[model samples]
Structures are given as structure tokens and as C-alpha cells.
Target: MTATTDESAFAAENAFGKGEPNIAYAQYFTGDSFLNNLVTDPECVVGVHNVTFAPGCRNNWHVHHATSGGGQVLICTAGSGWYQEEGKDAVSLTPGVVVFTRAGVKHWHGAKADSWFSHIALGVPGENTSNEWLEPVDDAHYAAL
Candidate 1:
């Protein structure tokens, strides 16, 4: 007997592969943005946050907070961008490549020096998940990229 499962949210719950679930739409975050909800799972608390940086937009320095520890991943799906940590050098990123950071590091990321940037934010699991925003990435630093 087939015990069919109710379609909770992910439209392609029964899908094989190679496509996002119907429920997971390609979202666009025009202006400044952040995570809306944090995932709650034992295996790994994971969530996807879509961000779009305007021509000259960027985020301030920030740190992730998790009981077990967590890091941010930027999967560039469009345009170009730069990422920098507190004491590390800046790195450029484009479509297809994935960038990562440590569990808790002070850093900032944003669009490229001459274009907009967009990526999906994914992180590990944590308790009392939160963030601490420090300072914005100045133009001098951005232009250096």
C-alpha cells in the first residue's frame, strides 16, 4: 500500500532532483535585507536568505550567533561582489561560486565595485540564533576590491 504524504510546503516533495521545490520561489530582495526566519532542526539548522545589492549597496560588519556555531555562505547567482573579514583580505565572487566564513567572525559583504550583487545566504545550526551588526563597509575598502 502507498502511504502518500501530505504536501506540507515544498511542492516537489516527491520530486527526484535538479529543481527547487515549487514552494521555494526565486525571491528578490531589492533593498537592504536580512533573514526572516531561522530553521530549527537537530541535524543542522539551515535556511536560505536571498539578498540583492543595489548598484552601490553593502552591509555592515556583523557576526553570527549560534549555540553550536555557524557560518555564512554566499552563493552568487547574479552580478558580482566582494567579501571581507575583519582581519582578512577581500575576495571577489560571481555567479556559480560559493564563499564561506568562520563560525563567528566580524565581516561584511556586498555588490562589486561597479555592479549589483545577489546571493543566497545559508548557515549552520545554532541556539538562540542571532546577529551583531557592526559598521558599514566604506567606499575606500570597497573600491580596493
Candidate 2:
């Protein structure tokens, strides 16, 4: 489905309730999305968040970097979505599918054109862990999928 189509559908429930507004840094995403931090305690080594993407919503290419070890893991919890690493084929995401993106990889993920999707993103902690958000995915490239 094209991102601009009118047939988009949203499931009754997409995992844990769509938490608070995303409040993502404006430069990081191309469309609407939300983020719900699930593990914020200082003692927790892993950061957990529930991300909900509106139909056709997607973030820009980014990387989770760490000097030794650290990356990001996305566990699909509801609806449908897509994930793609730089120079790799786009992967369909459904409930239970897990995408583990190792550190230093450039990747992007979001809801499909016609579906609202949700997933739990686990942030693996490591020395000097940081996120680097890059350019948005172009429309032509995204529509080709």
C-alpha cells in the first residue's frame, strides 16, 4: 500500500497501550510516531521502550554505537511493520518477530503503508553507547518496497 492511500488500518490494540507522545527530536523521523519508555530506573542496565508508529510513519536511518558492545533489539508486539539494514532487503515484521541490529549498523524501521504497528525496543547498554540519527528515507526508496 502506498503511504498516501486511504485504506490504512489500525488494530484494536497494538501491544501495551500507545504510551505518551513520542517527543522525538524533530530531526530524527519522517512521519508521526510515539515512544513510551518502559524501563527508566537508574538501576536497569537495559532501556526498554514501546514504540508505536502511525500508518506509514517511519524514522530516519540511524545507528546505535558502542565501543565494545551495544546495539538495539526490536520485538514486534502488534500489527505490521518493516525493517531494513543498509544495503539489505527489507524484512516484514509481525507479532513475535525480533530484529536484532548490531552496533554500528545503519538501519530504519516503521509501520507499513497500510498498518499501524508497535514494538518493544530494547536498548542494550555498553560503554560509550550513543545513537546517531541520519537522513530520512527518501519517498521513492520507501515506496519501492
Candidate 3:
């Protein structure tokens, strides 16, 4: 192992990497809504992120790999949203609603098609937690919302 020393590099900070367009994921899931992932803990630590959905927005199908042994938790902070597991009906997720995702379960979630939504997402600290980003839910699937 290479020996390393602790250091701090503080530069002029202006934003929390939010001003840019469609930066977190890669493409727009729904309108301007996107995911801001902060994988601070590589393993044995917690990970955090935020999902902000604009009016008439949603997200594509995706899954989270267990880090150590836990899954993910989503705390709705503003507006409204929804969460559903694979092969299950969508559940309503509004302000004050907390949702937990099962480890290694394939699922998708986002704001209601007609409302803006924002939520803080957190995952358990584990050994090499991974994320599998799947296909975007097209208009056909979104129209059903």
C-alpha cells in the first residue's frame, strides 16, 4: 500500500455543483430533474445524494448494489414523489414520506408527472456499493403516470 498524508485543499466555493445542466446522471430523466450523487464513503461509510425533479418530471429505472449490507433510504423533503419496487404498483411518496429500498432490488422512482419534487437520498456504508443505471422510461411509460 502506498503511504499517504492528510491534506486540505480549500478553493473558492461558489455552488454545490447544482448550477450545471443535467450533470449528475448524464441525461435528463424528466425535464430538468436529475440526481446529484455524492459517494463520499468508498466502503464502510455512508453515501448521500439528492434528487430534484421539475414539474412534469420523473426518473429512469435503476438499481443500487449493497455496500456493506444495507440498501438505500430516501427522505422526502419537498414537493411530492413516488417509489415502487420491481413487480409492484407504485407507492405515493409525498413530503414527510420516507422510503427504503431493498439491497440489490431493481426499482425506479421520481416526482409526480405534474408536480416538482426534491428528496435526500442516503445509502448504507458497505464494501463497494455499486449503481446500475438502466434505460430511461420513455414517454409511453411516462404517459401512464
Best by TM-score: 2
**What stretches of model 2 exceed 4 Å from their correct place?**
1-11
Best of the two (2, 3) by TM-score? 2
Clashes of 1: 1
**Per-residue lDDT tens digits of candidate 2, residues 9-99?**
3334554767766775546777778888887798999999999887788899999999978999999988788999999999999888999
**Judged by TM-score relative to the true structure, which candidate is superior, 1 or 3?**
3
After superposing candidate 3 on the true structure, give the runs of residues whose Cα lies further than 4 Å from its correct spot.
Answer: 1-22, 34-44
Could you give candidate 3's per-residue lDDT for residues 1-145 as a string of tens digits?
A: 1111111110111112222345666563756755566565566366677676665566677888865676788887665567777788788777678988877887777766656566778876556788887777667755675
Residue 54 of model 2, lDDT score = 79
- Give me the overall lDDT of model 3: 0.64
lDDT for predicted candidate 1 compared with the true structure: 0.59
Residue 133 displacement (Å), model 1: 0.5
Q: TM-scores for all candidates?
A: 0.66, 0.90, 0.72
lDDT of each: 0.59, 0.83, 0.64
TM-score (C-alpha, index-matched) for candidate 3: 0.72
